[model samples]
Target: NRRGLPEGHADVKRMMTVPIMRNDEIVAIVGVGNKAFDYEAEELEVFARYADSVWDSIQVKRVEDALWQSREIYRAVVENSTDSIVRCDVNGKFLFGNEAAIKLLGGAEAAPIGKTPEELGFCPAFRHTWDASLQYVVAQGFPASFEFDMEIAGRTQTLDMRFAPEYSPTGRVVSVLGVARDITERKIAERELARREEQYRVLTETMKDVVWVLDIESSKFRYVSPSVYALRGYTSEEVVALPVDHAMTPEDRAALKALTLDRVAEFESGSLAADHFYVDQFPQPCKDGSVVWTEVVSNYYINPDNQRLELRGVTRDITERRQAEVALRQARDTLEQRVEERTRDLTRVNAELAAAMQVKDEFLSVMSHELRTPLNAILIMSQVMLEGVRGSLNERQLRAMQTITESGQHLLAMINDILDITSVQAGTVVLDRALHEVDALCAPLIDRLRAEAATRSQSIDYVCPSEPLYLWADGRRFGQIVRHLLENAMKFTPDGGQISLFVQPDLDRRVLSVRIEDNGIGIAHDAIERIFQPFTQADSALSRQFGGSGIGLTLVRHLVELHGGTITAESAGMPGSGSRFTVQLPWQAPPVGSPHGAILAAGAVHGPHVVLIADDNPSAQRVMGDALRAAGYEVLAALDGIEAVATARLRPPDLILMDMQMPRCDGATAIRRLRQLPACAATPIVAMSSVVVPNDRALCLDAGADDYLAKPISADTVVDVVARHLAPGRSLIDAASGADARPS
Candidate 1:
């Protein structure tokens, strides 16, 4: 009472004070004064009860005000949300939806009350899903979320939706609240990503090389290609499930892992660029429990989504290469020791051997460069004239050119035979193996040879399998081998003789036999044994008459052998009975993307196409330029490096054909300068070199040439190379008339 009304009253009539208590705690004092009648105990008690009631009313009003403010805050949040928000009654009917939800639903400000998702014309599947989720929330008295697709507008849209039950005072569920988000774009991106991953998986499975992705930290394969099976008889699925170092010897595995970890650390710390891929070799564990040497090339990359470093790599069986290297070393050591043993008596032999080697080296260099360069020009220019890409020619001239072409081709064949023999002797040539389709190869070859056969008065017949045949081999060498057999048949078959070719696969044996038979001058029965011997002919008289190097069959045999196949000759030894050469090659499907190594198609491109040819040889320049002009490209000829640099600077051409061996600075040097200039940095520059050596190619590439071509480049090669380099997103290739071999 002392604490009531501040103890200051001016009226001094009557006063009453009551304590406002909540849960038996004094919250405040309620007081009233200036009563006219005297107050008794009963009246005071009544006044106290009235005061408690009044306090209860005030608390109730305060609670109502707080609730209204909280609702206003919620409304503000809902209106401004980018996601669609909706409120629904217990019967799965929409109570209300935000502006975003209305816009998403594509309506003109219509009330959403009493409308179900089905009534709103949502897809039935999605509506059913929503109804099920809402029912679950209502039943469980909790929240639920799901992702589903709906066609609100014309296009389908993906949405993430969540439903939460709203309960009444009695804990009865009355309504539901939902938040929906339009994730259509995100869903589309996810599908696209899945498609690409599936595409990658297909490509990986088709590869001949063991391609894999590794989680570096876990040392486990995240992905692997089917080539693992071919390499060591392990399925792609099996390999991926194995540890990263599953195929290495324990010692090699430990060492390699350490090395790999160090490299990974460098990659993560920014010391090494992701662009660089490193190579490592170690022994691999085969599914058969055998160990084979493998060469692994790997690059570090950061997976964007997970931000984890990953290793993408390809592995190849390198046991043969390693063995070859060791054999070479042993041979060298033996030769050195033998020389030392015969040191006193071998002075004359050593001098003779050195002189012989020098002569051989000079011959090879001239044959590849000096000899082939001029021949390339002649054959290309002749071919262009024959094709009528140049002006028309009379019959006599055309026939003469045809004679010239045949002669040049003969000379080229002779040159190639020598090259192959040399490579075999030196052991320098290795197979650039790839996949090829048998039909695709044979069709073009037969078409090409038919014209020559017709001229020779030889009628040809060919039989192929009903189904498409695919095999793994060096397409160029395979084509070459087949062409040789056919050419031999065509050459020997007398005028009006029939040459028949047969291709059939032995499915059970997994081998394919290409049988070529000619009803021409057959081998003598006595001399059949010497027919395939190198540099030997069936008969001296027949050799003179047929006009052949006699080594064609020898080279063919070698090529077949290199491809791990066999060749056999059958003849009745009666002249005019013809001969049969059957090459039985093992059946293997070439890796994916391998057939492309042999074929190139340059689609029509819009262009006032400019091609710049930089060569010191005027004849070579003339040859390539004419070919370019024929292929719808404007030609720019540069005689030397200086001129090439100047012309490129004056007007940047779409492509540059840089000759590596040039006066006053070579093509490599010029390429370096041209690449330094921004205009030519990305311009395709194919380095042409008469050196025909691996080192020369390495030098050209190191100097920034986009591609490299050895000498003996022909018109078709020139045209093809230009088209290949100019074609959208195609790699450069060799200009040789042989196999359209891609640049290594």
Candidate 2:
């Protein structure tokens, strides 16, 4: 080696340099000087080996320093952590416990080192669950987590616990490191959130308004309430899957899409508040192929959890409200026009209507007399002939006479029905109330109509309780009600059809129900209400097949109502389906401890009573006289009111039947004159007439008649009236005072 030192350098005889390498990089240098000889190969090799050993030692020292620094950092973290951290051996003996762990047990004095949880006096419940989790980690060589309860200080704490197996260098699980977090407040918050969610779900599920959530970006429903199905005929799941505009019409869909985009843009631009509502109305199509109007109220909001912009809304059906608005607008538009037109026509129309009504009232009054007078003669003669008064009749002759009598009676009934409806409409009809036995009132009607039912080969089934049930009503009108209802049933029923009458009296409700059912024809459901209107039938074709003025049921209903009752008609609208008419009438039982007295007593007069017949028509006088004479009574006939007074003065008859209309003088004037006489002052006088209006009946009784009878009288009615009056203890009837002299 040549000496190449600078002027102040140290002198060296021999020198060698060795490179120290670690991981293929130079880490340090080793140099030797003044070795007393030149460096040999053996000595250099020895120095190289020695340099490698020294490098190994430096690496070990570096590793030790790094590990100690890492352990100090771990200790700091474990001690400062809020979570309780501890290490336990495989036998569950505590190896170490951090400050938090010691605090969790109680304090520094209660540190868990060198003690199992049992020895440390931990709650058994927490210890069991924690120890099981630790043992599982040791056996499975994995981490385990659980939730447990531990009593710390004076309060029980809910803690989330985790156990992890600590492995040695050979991968053996030596001990378990446990960490417990106090999550009591967090658990309470989660429970409260779950409870609030349940309440929201319940409210949305039950409410009729549809609640929904829509994703702003996708324009699709994210959640929909169960009520969406009721609102739009789409299930919640189906609605959630469908686009927001699926229920809208094509035009509405396009409009709504543009509107929604504008709304979102407004929100983004900060022009609209997040809590602001967007309310709109549009028509939506239903699954049933119908369109309905809907109102949607929505608010744009960003979901806090997902940071998603969403629309929360409620929708309601507004079809009915919209329709009402349209109707109101139309009515408002036409109101002024109609008012002007009506104002112009009111005076003239009023005059015309007044004249028409006056003429109509006069026509009905005159027709009642003109029609019933001849009807009376026809009915009287036909009835007399049928009873074999003149001679015996063959079967065909009897039926022919019967047919004539029936036709005349039917005409008379039509006239009476027209007058009745007129009186009912005018609200002038008055009822003559009397205590009547229900059985007695109903039996005669059934017997009278049974022959007609027999002609059609049909039978009427009559049902009534055997007990004596009474009703406080007009007996004659009640009889008329039953007859009309039964006739209606027979008319509609086919030949061989069945009719049933059920009479039920309810004492508790104080009502009587009369149900008339027939197996003939049924009415249509739509026409059930129409049939109650005057001159309206269930079907127009029925009028052709069945001869009716269509006013029978109308009159029946009016009469029923006048008697303080209600009537209902039921039918199925099919032939052979039959019909049912039920009538409910107010019923009142008689006084409990009172005796009922008859209006007139028969058989009180010992001798044969004279009944003077006074009338203008010879046929009427002859028919009445003949019927009276056959009833074992002395009969006097007068063709006019003049002879009637004269005959009564000479004879002083026990009873007098006076006709209202007569030639020369009317029966009213004659009765006044006859009452002036002492012998005839107390005599019972009945006024008979063809005009049966309420005023007409009042007029006759006001003129001192005991009772008033309409024309077309039956022989039984005439005889019964005479017998009742001729009996003793009969008082004069005062018509002006509203006294009823007629028997029930």
Q: Rate the local accuracy (lDDT) of all candidates.
A: 0.79, 0.81
Query: Quick one: RMSD of model 1?
Result: 24.6
State the lDDT of candidate 2 residue by residue for 379-408, as single tens digits: 999999999998999999999999998899
Off by over 4 Å in 2: 1-13, 19-28, 34-37, 40-50, 168-172, 304-308, 327-744
RMSD of 2: 25.8
- Model 2: weakest 10-residue lDDT segment is 729-738
Backbone clashes in candidate 1 total: 3
lDDT, candidate 1, at 363: 88
Q: Tens-digit lDDT track for model 1 on 103-149?
A: 87656554456688777777779878888888889999989888978
User: Which candidate leads in TM-score?
Assistant: 2
